[model samples]
Target: MAPVPKTMSGILIEEVGGPEVLQWKTDLPVPELKDGEILVKNEFIGINYIDTYLRTGLYKAPLPLITGREAAGYVVASSSPDFKEGDRVTYLADHSYAEFTAVPDVSAVIVPDDFSTEQAAAALLQGLTALTLIREAAGIKQQLGISQGPFVLVHAAAGGTGLLLVQILAVNGAKVIGTASTPEKLALTKENGAAWVINSKEEDVTARVKEITSGNGVDVIFDGVGKATFDANFDIIARKGTVISFGNASGAVGPVDLFKLTPKNAKLVRPTLFNYITTKEERRAFTEELFELISSGKVKLRIHDVYPLKDVARAHQDLEGRKTTGKLLLKV
Candidate 1:
């Protein structure tokens, strides 16, 4: 392996506003490894809505921050025995919008030889989000009362995480209802595993959902559209159902009235992926399952575009505009 560099190139956010604030710098200091840390020379970085959240100040972080949550690369230096030079890896960590990142040993997972770095980068964060949502946030598999698999509603069903949710839910025998705005997105949602698709742009989502469910409402809703779709969840959720609100693509949900869930005996969950995999054992188990799904062709990935590091502003613009579908990546 080549010697680790003293400085690296990456996007730095000095002020929170818009994509224009993602300033690219060639002389940013390379992160130094602390105990149990691995220094990764990033090859590909995953672009997530959370990155935009941080960039726009919707999610707060200190100024002059290097903002990104995940990246796939090869190790260049390590302070832990778990990783060695040239070991390919993908990890969840801060400051991933860079050429190199200092990742905690517990957060980094070694990439199997057969899994390309691109696949690892594209699948790690969003893939895990889907898996954890079904298995942890909603605990679909443990709901023994729902014998025939619960009816699931996945908003943005053609997007990166939504597609995974549809596939996994269908594979587990759940009847899935996916919502997307465009015809192309709706068709893609159907192709992925949705039993029904609703065009949120043209149709009344609540009424369509009611019609599809024969007026019983859905048993579970995976709503990432936040404020725009939050209230409607209560209107469509069945008795004893779960509503998992995991993202804020439109805007953050306002204060909730716990009373809203009372009428249906419903449950609301606001979960983050990190909380679901807090230990090495938990991380390994979830990651192994996700990888198996990918290898078995049950969970196929769709890369919307791989932007050059210098074009990150355009990448963010496209994402915020909802102009692209599937995962966006940055080649470092």
Candidate 2:
């Protein structure tokens, strides 16, 4: 292995506003490992909507931050015995839009022998988000009770995390109804195992969902579209159903009355992936299940594009514009 360099290439955000704030620099300092952290030479970084939120000041972070949540690469230095130099890993961490990241041992997982760094990067964050959204956030199994398969709805069904949700829900035998604005995305959703796809652009989503569910409404709603689709989720959710609002792709939802969920006894939850995998055991369990699904061909991750680190601004532009579908990655 090469000696670790003091300086590395990365995107540094000094101001918060738009994609333009993501300025690429060659002289950014490589992060130093903490006692329980490992230094990874990042090969590929995952681009998520959270990155966009942090970049635009929608989500708060300090100035001059290196903003990204996940990356996959080879460990180059370690402050813990669980990892060593040359171990391939994918991790959930801070400051990932860079050539290297200091990853907490609790949040990092070794990439399996069958997976590539690109796959690991693309799959980890969004994949686990999908898993935890279904299992932890929604509690699909317990919610289903004796029902063989529950009716579930996923907003932005062709998007990165949306696609994963559709596939994983299908694998668990849910009848998934996915929403997309375009025919291409609707088709993509169906291809990924959605039992039905709603063209959120042209159709009345609430009416269509009512008709599909025979007026019972869906058992669970995985809503990542945020404010744009939040209200409709209540209208289309069945009695005692769960609504997991996991992202703010269409902007954050406003204050809730809490009374809206009262009529149907609906359950509303806003879960962040990080909260679900706080401990090492939790992270490892979810990550292992996600990897097993991918490796077994039960779930597939779609990489929309791999942008150069310097081109992160354009990537963010495409993401916020809703111009691309599936996972976006940055090659370091």
RMSD of each: 1.7, 1.7
* Global lDDT of each candidate: 0.92, 0.92
What are the per-residue Cα lDDT tens digits for candidate 1 across 34-118?
Answer: 9999999999999999999999899999999999999999999999999999899999999999999999999999897778999
| lDDT at residue 203 of model 1 (Cα atoms) | 95
Residue 211, candidate 2: Cα error in Å is 0.6
**Where does model 2 exceed 4 Å of error?**
142-147
TM-score of 2: 0.97
lDDT of 1: 0.92
Model 1, C-alpha of 248: deviation from truth (Å): 0.6
> Model 2 over residues 152-176: C-alpha lDDT tens digits?
9999999999999999998888989
The local lDDT score (0 to 100) that residue 163 gets in candidate 2 is: 96
